[model samples]
Target: MKQWLQAFIAAIQFLTRIPVPVNVPFTNEVLKRSTLFYPWAGCIVGVLIWGAGLGLQLVLPAGPAAVLTLALAVALTGGLHMDGLMDTADGVLSHRSRERMLEIMKDSRVGAMGVIACILVLLLKWSLIASLMTAGAWQLWLVVPFIWSRAAMVWGMTNEPYARAESGLGSYFQGLHRGHLLGAVFSALMLSLATVYIMVSVPLEMAGWSASFAALAAYAIHPWWLLLGAPVLGMGAVWGCSRYLSKKLGGLTGDTYGAMNELTETILLLLLVLMTGWRG
Candidate 1:
């Protein structure tokens, strides 16, 4: 139990800026094992974002709520994925040689393409989130996107080769075996189930069994059900993305991991809007 707790804490430390206030060994083997809890860390991020979204909507308009919530997502991860998105756009969209593309991604300077990609991705997320909030789709299902995004990163990292030959943060995860991927998906599923329990049991306690059961019935139409299939859908999408990026840059890099995450999160959000708000 102590060891698992340490692994989970290591995951939170690696994935977010959240101060866990625990001492854990930072080693290659620990880092590789920490991949198991990436989705678990993502579940924490998802729950926080969902709670904030709900609180924000109560006092503020949807537009400002969307902005703040989006900002919170970036802040939690210290803009790590956003930086990757920009770096990837600068490299992949530049149409340069594969080697040169890799070099461009490694460069710290952001280019025009990178800026544009960041802008577009943020805009899409902002619009989708605002629309969902506006349409009153504040179900726990919203958390799935956050969870799947990180899980997609784990899926990509475990299954794909590292682009860099010698160095880069992505290389540390190269030791990941099949167990890491299995554990990640399992963690994501367990997190989703816990969310279900929270959403259902809290309402049951506060409003009595009648109201709780009614809320349960509403799951028929809730996007939360998609949580069950996200492992398959998210991994498949990440696989296709890894292959595409690998064809261009030879393999996945740390930047591509972030790129995959941002893209997957946005795509999943778009699907949520379709599933919940686009009803006839």
Candidate 2:
């Protein structure tokens, strides 16, 4: 339990700017256990986005608000996942053998496929955020998708072997135990519940007590029932990405994990926005 808590703290420290009162013990064991903490890391990221978007709404116009929201998502993580998505896309579509595909992913130059993938993903994210803001379902849809996306990364890392001997972070997490896997899922579930309580229930209660708050509050924009979709999509993404990577490269890479997280989040966000039936 201590080790698991340490792993959680380490993940929070590494993944977000949030202060979590954690001093990570950087041992090999701690690093291995860190995979379990990934979903919590994602929760921190989601909270950052939620807070930032709410604050931005108070100050910025709709045009600039959408841009800021997407920009914060990219900037918060240093665009690490997006880079992975681009590189992996290039590698997969390079029309090469497994070894050559891995080689392409390692290459520094962005290939044609990478450029196209990046552009499309960025545009899709921009559109999704705009739709979410227009519908006011931003918090409801944003929370679990972001949380579960990183959980998907944990699933991939724990289940798949490392594709390359010295490729990336996946090599570090490939041997994570079942305990680690369960820890990640539990953490994600807890975070999802917390988000629902705060984003849905608290608001509803506050609006009930105060007319001014109710007037300013858009009618609970996102459906609470949509919360269940995140974990399902997250698990599916991990299974599909790992299966494809194993077929193509005989294993998985850190880049593939990051790529999977980014792709899943984008897909989840789009689905959530569409489900809200908000055309923006």
Candidate 3:
């Protein structure tokens, strides 16, 4: 139990800027459990993202809800994942050797490819979220996607090999035990079930139960569908990172995994929002 607590705290430290007191001794085993916390941290990020959307509804006109929600997402996560997304984008598109790719990712300079990917992704998320708000499926927007996005992050961590040989985020999580896996999976399932129940129970304006369920079906299908897509995408990321590491420095590092998490979240959010809009 202490180890689990320690792992949770470590996860909070690893995934967010949130401060956590770490009096617990640092060991490789503790760090391994910390990987379980990454998904939960994503859950926290998702909640904040939902809160930001809610706050926007309260403070701004409906017309600007999407933009405000997008801003809040970046602000809540301190754009940490977004930065990784950009870096990974630049690296993946570089089409250079592995070493050069990693070098490009590490470089602070923004390339055209990275900039364009970031803009398009953000715009997609903003537009989808706005459409959901416009259609008044606001509560579904608040919960289901948030849980799935984090779960997707866990899927990425569990399936992908660290692109690098040492000192990277993937390396830290390598070969995590079944206990850690169960912890992440269980937390994610509980959150997902809760979100689904709320979506099913919550009334959207004057919409009938049939219509609400129909509308929420999109969100319901997202995580399961993405269960297939995320692994494919995650594999691509791992492959890209691996190539970059092998060609450049002989392996992946922690920051690269950070890049993977960010990209995965962005894609997952965009997919969920779009599906929800269609159903709503």
Top candidate on lDDT is 1
RMSD list, candidates in order: 2.5, 3.3, 4.9
Candidate 3: segments with Cα more than 4 A from true spot: 19-27, 177-179, 201-256
Error of 3 at 105 (Å): 1.8
Number of clashes in model 3? 10
After the best TM-score superposition of candidate 2, give how far the Cα of residue 172 lies from its true spot, in angstroms.
Answer: 1.7
> Candidate 1 local accuracy as lDDT?
0.86
Residue 199 shift from truth in candidate 3, angstroms: 3.2
lDDT of 2 at 112: 91
- Candidate 2 residues 203-238, lDDT tens each? 667667576356435534344455456456656766
What is the TM-score of candidate 3? 0.74
> How big is the positional error of residue 159 in model 3, measured in Å on the Cα after superposition?
2.8
Q: Model 1 clash pairs?
A: none
Q: Which ten residues in a row have the lowest lDDT in candidate 2?
A: 215-224
Q: By lDDT, is 2 or 3 better?
A: 2
Q: Pick the candidate with the highest TM-score.
A: 1
- What is the TM-score of each predicted model, taking all chains together? 0.91, 0.86, 0.74
